[model samples]
Every structure is written in C-alpha cells, then in structure tokens.
Target: MSEYYGTTVEDIFKTQNKRFRAEGSEGVDAVFAYDVQGEGGGRWKLTIKDGACATEKLDSDDFGEYSVKITVDAETFVGVTIGKIDGTEAFTAGKLKVDGQIPLMMELPKLFTKYAPPGKEVTAADILATSESRFQPENAEGLDITVGYNLAGDGGGQWTAVIKDGTCKLEEGLRDNLTVCNIVKAKDFVDLMLGKLDPIVAFGAGRLRLVGDMEIAQRLPKIFSKFKSNASEPVEELIMLKKIISVDMKYSTGPTMGKFLNGLKEKKILANVCPKCGRKQLPPRECCAVCRCDVDEFVEVGPEGIVTYCDIIYYASPDPLTGETRETPYGALFVLLDGCKDREALWHLLKKEDLVDVKRGDRVRPVWVENPTGSVYDIIYFEKVR
Candidate 1:
C-alpha cells in the first residue's frame, strides 16, 4: 500500500464522496501532486489542494509546499492527464508512483467519479433510447427535429437522428423530412452535438456543413448550452480564442420587449412607425421623435408575403432550447408582408437555397401552426407559395 501526501488517492475519493453525501462538503484541506510528462522529455507538476487545482513547471520552488506527491513514469503521466486512462488503468500500467497515505490513494476512484466525463460511444440508437426514456409533453410541444452526422468528413456518410412523436422509417429510399449533411469525423460531430463549435466555425473551418434548416444553426447553441459540462477547462488558450472572435449573441430583453412579445401573441404586429416620415416600422418601438407621436397601434398584417432578401445560417448558440447545431447552410429570409409597407419585413425560416430562383418579389404565404397564439412565432414563417 502506497501513500499520497499522507494519504492514498483511492481513499481520498471515498472520503470525499462520503463527506459530500453526508454533509454536502468538498475537500477541506488536501493536497496532491502529479509529475506530468509533456510531448518532449519535459515534465510538469499538477497540484490540487483545499479544492483548488493548479499546474506549474516541474522544477519550481512550489514543489516544497505539496502535502502529497504522486510520481509516475513521464509517458504515463501525460497519457492520464490527457484522458487516456482511468486511475486504475494508470496504476496497472506501472505508471503511477504514490507517496503519502495509501488510504487516501484508494479513494481516488470515488473522487474521479464525481468528475466523470459524459458517456463515450453514444450511438444513434443510444440517443434515441434516452430520448424515449425522457419523453415528456413539454419536449414534444415545440418543433419536430431530426439530427444526422457525417462521420467521414467527406459529406457522404449515413446520418441518424431521433424524431419527436414520429418514427424515422425509410421507405423506398425516402425518409420523411430527413435532414442530412457531409460530416468528416465523429469527434467533430460530437462537438456539434455538444455545442462546442458554431455552425459558421465548423463550416468555415471545414469541419461540417448543413444540408437543411439553416435557422437550426442559430438555435443549436442555445440548445447545447443546456448540457454543457460542469467542469471548467484551463482558460489560457480559450481566452486567446475569445479575443479573435468578439461577438456574443446572448443579449438581455427588458420589460418593454416583454410587452411587445405579449402583443405578438394576440396576432398583432406592432411596429414603431416613424412619426417624421410616417414609415411603418417592423420591430415595435416606444417613441417617434421625428413626428414626436407615440405610435401604439396594434396593426393586423397579412399572413401572406414575398421574399425580399435571404441569407444562409450555419451556427449554434449556447442556449438550451435549440438542440445541437445543425450543419452549415440553411436559409433565412427577410419577408415583406402583403399588407405592410415601408421596410416592414419579418425575419423567419425560409426553406430555400440562397442560389434559388427567389428574389425581390417571390410570392410567399405564412405557414401558421395549428392553434395560433398571436405571438410573432405563432406563424412559423412565410414560404414561397409556388
């Protein structure tokens, strides 16, 4: 039996779990050290104590303060730290060197269990099964979605997804409303599912591309953020990544916007008509300084429209409502309603390619969901009638 600081890793994990279970406590005063091997013959020290973890250069003066020391062969340490093995596997590989308390070392597994990664090898069948087990009325209330992956990265791979309230049965080489894409690798696919990569980043970086539902790209981040890992990764590199792209989409909506949303539920399109030029606005407004009139009329607009402009979407958000980000290249169109004039365009999903025949005056009709609630979303969007 070896020791870690004055304890064993396994024992530490057990004690921590017991304490957490009984008293909802984390570690009180504990310190453990690891000699990690780098890509070269280099090594580093990773220390955790009093619920804080840190990494340092191998030969620093900080080594004197560690309470427990675990030395391992350099190669083994690198593999373990980089997620190549479990604690037990590392020990069995003759790569672990524990010096402290054997009892604490024995508890290492229990502690690691608390920080376990999400399950590996989640197949399409596995996700479908989980969806079935967790099926609820609320989950089925919104849109019906299908997800697929092209693990080959060549965009010529089989795709699978779980459908809500519908069976994904392929008949005569046709699937019902199935969306597909050319994915290159499973890791990239999983990153998309986990919302780690934005649709734009994935496509622009040559990771993934969309074959359908470009709006799903914008909604994917919101959906995947719900399942984000509780653990935090080292931010040294990530912070630099953030600096390169400085746009964040999660903005707060105040009480005024809340009122406007309520009005949309009543099937009224509220606009902030400019008093100066008498221009009917699209998004609602509070004041009109040009004419200095408070435009508060809840106007009823037509459910028919024409496509004025459109763009493709291939990105994900961190919000949980939208599931994993879809592949790149879905259509978003700025629609001009039949009865509204003066830049009154509604932004919503359009099931068309950017290179399609749609232009400034394509006829379109609002595709309303059953039992409209008057919310702007009450009508999904206007689709080209032809």
Candidate 2:
C-alpha cells in the first residue's frame, strides 16, 4: 500500500493544524520541514503563520523560511508519525537527524496528533506466527540463523524462525529453541514491538532474557523494520508508561547505622569495617558477609571511588522513585570505594561524557544536593573523578 494510503501526507498536516489550533498553537511562528528519504522519499514543510498551519512540498535543501528541519528515512518518519517509534527516542537513537531550532523540533509531537499505524491489536502470537511473512530476506542476506520465542500468557505459544541462506520459514512450536532463544512475557512482547518499552532496559532488568547465541539476538534490531498498521492518535504513554505507586516506608537504623547517617551531613564517608576480615562496607552493613561478625570499627573511605563495572543505558522506563525518566545515554555503574577492598562496591549513575573515558579502576565521586538528608537522595549521583 502507498505509505499513509496515497496523498495522505498533506491530509495529515491539515489534521495536525486543526489539532494545533485546538491546543491554542503552542509554539511560536515558524516553518518546520522534513527531508524524508527512502520508500516515500520527499521534502515537506509545515509553516505556522499567525496561528494557522500551512504545508507545501519543497524542491530543494535550501531550507527557505523553515526554523526547524529534520531529515530521516521515509520509513522512520512514518514510524514516528504512526507512533510505532517515539519521536524523542528516535532522535536520540540517531534514526532522526535534525538541525536548526532544536526546542521547536522538540515541541512538534505535542503540536500534532499522535498516529498509530492500523494494527494496534498486535499480540505476541501474531508477531511470532507471522515471522516468515514479516521477514525481510534482503536484511537476512548472507546469513543463516534460527530464532525462537518462548512467550508466556493466554496468548502463550511457542514459535520458531528457521533461517538458511537469507530465507526464513516459520513453525508453531519450539524446535532447536535454544539455538538462540528469547524468553519474555507475552504482554512485554507487545510493548517491545509498539515502542512503549525499551529493549535494553528490559534486558538489564531481566524482564527479557536471551539465552544461547547472543550475537544473533543483538542482530534482531537490524533484521526487521517497523510494522505497518492502523492510524489513530498515539496514547498518553507515547514516551514511557509507568505506574505511580505510593506507600509508607520505615526502616530500622540502630545506633551504629544512625551515626553513619549523621556523618553524611558533615560530608564524611562512614564505612563499617569488619575487624576480622578487614573489609569495609560503604553503606555500613551490620555484619560482614565474609567474616560473619558485627562490623564495629568505622573507617572513612570516600566521597570518591574507582569504577569497576559499567553499562550504557540507551533506553529505559520511568524511574520508580520520581515517576519520571532520566535523559537517555546515561551510565549505570559499580564503584569500589577508596581504602575499601574484598570487592565491596556501591552502585550509582555516571555521566554520558565520562562513559567513554571512565573505565575499570577510574576514580569517581558523588554529586550532592543543597540540603543534606539522611536518605540516599542526599547525594544526587556519582560522576567521574577527572
């Protein structure tokens, strides 16, 4: 089918303009242009003039009066428009490249209607059962690999994709399922396809597990493209959907631990040292795991430590604490405090810039907020020492 059903781009703009007007034209007067390539490749611009929207197909890269411009493949543009791809996530993922007014580009999603490409009811079985049909032989070119999906639920069903010399055939149940298997809840499989969930975070959180042939699992992203479906407004959860749960919490911090929390206000690192094992616990564990004795000796270790392990979080769901998500491309790390040994480590955040330079054994320190609070939030996060 013609992308967006032939001659529909302008119709989309008209509809978008109506939506913008209803929302009282949130942005300043400006021209927004999309330089699209691939399948439905073309240049189009939507201009906001005196609170009204206008559109036209452009003939060149000469930006003209446009203040914000983005260039992306026709497929990705359609995915973004249809809500299969979150606009901000696509930009961050480098699928959408932009120049000129960034703030305006960021506002475009809110100015227009969120569209869902026709098939919103995609289920886990539908995705796996149709694997052979959904397969792009060209992408599988020069490669042969079998993939298996172990999805759980009422939609629960086993599926297998047998690939040989750039061709794929499907099966209803597992056969060599462990060749390269993915185990996930049927619902999460739906969210993964719909862009409501981030795969990297899912893997990190153990919600999605891949066993055997990890390299093949990583290739999954490139081998398949966006699925075509229905057109409707995107949901309020176009970004990341998370539940806001509130509860009362209380914890017992006896005399020993209480002193440590009080010392945080004075900017001291109080680690409980186990005399028997000579290991220090930064959070001040009541007892050492190795020695099996109460940690009585307090030793000051660090507002600084060395990174022992880290991973880049390119995508993730909302933070459970604040009900909000942090910007992507941040790092999650394990740091070993100075003067601390026996593999005792503290986990925290790292900056994007430091991610490239910081490595195992590289020193880091914590960033703190204005007022000192006994809770963990007293220190904002960790950063590279240099």
Q: Which segments of candidate 1 are over 4 A away from where they belong?
A: 1-263, 266-276, 289-292, 316-323, 326-328, 352-356
Q: TM-score each candidate.
A: 0.32, 0.49
Tens digits of lDDT, candidate 2, 1-386: 23643233444544555566536465468888888877657788888867677777778777677787888887777777766668878888898987776556545655665643343466776666566667787877877777888899867778888888888888778885356988999999878877889999899999999988888788877676665444343456646564667798997898778878877777677888788868778788788888888888887877788888998885566667753556766898888877877577878888677877778878889888788887666767788876
Question: Backbone clashes per model, in order?
Answer: 54, 7
Tens-place lDDT digits, model 1, residues 181-250: 3345656655555567675788898767666777754544443323333333333532223133345688
TM-score, predicted candidate 1 vs. hidden true structure: 0.32
> Judged by lDDT, which candidate is best?
2
**Model 2 lDDT on a 0 to 1 scale:** 0.75
Global fold similarity of model 2 (TM-score): 0.49
In model 2, the Cα lDDT at residue 24 comes to: 47
